[model samples]
Target: MAGHYVIAGKKIPNHILSMGFIGAYAGAYALYALKPKPAQPATPPIQASSSDEEAFIKEFLAKAEAEESK
Candidate 1:
């Protein structure tokens, strides 16, 4: 025989608990799936040129090194 649940003090079948968990999961999934998504920009963002990025990185490292020497 299935033992009584400690909290409820009743013999709850395993199948019932499994069904409850499945129902809860399905309900949560339905809520998430139906939620509206944020709008996206029409135009993509502009990126910096490779040369400009390299220059910025060099400048940053130079400043960091200068500060470390102080």
Candidate 2:
């Protein structure tokens, strides 16, 4: 929805979505060829406490134990 309009102040039809995609791909290609590749910013890794990981393990173990006891 963000880049779905033309700079000429015209509304774009659904069919022109492919054209927008091609233009973006071409721009990216040009950047790749002429510039040093940009480093992606790192996202913070999700940290789970040992207890939280254990809880998930315990849940699966409980299911297995219940099935085994049946």
Model 2, range 1-70, lDDT digits (tens) per residue?
A: 4455565788786558788889999999999899977788664444557888868877777799899999
RMSD of each: 12.0, 14.7
Stretches of candidate 1 off by over 4 Å are 1-7, 43-70
Q: Write the per-residue lDDT of candidate 1 for residues 3-66, one digit (tens) a residue.
A: 4344477777777787898999999999999999999996464455787896887788779989
Instruction: Score every model by TM-score.
Output: 0.48, 0.32
- Relative to the true structure, candidate 1 reaches a TM of 0.48
Q: Which stretches of candidate 2 lie over 4 Å from their true place?
A: 1-12, 36-70
Best of the candidates, TM-score: 1
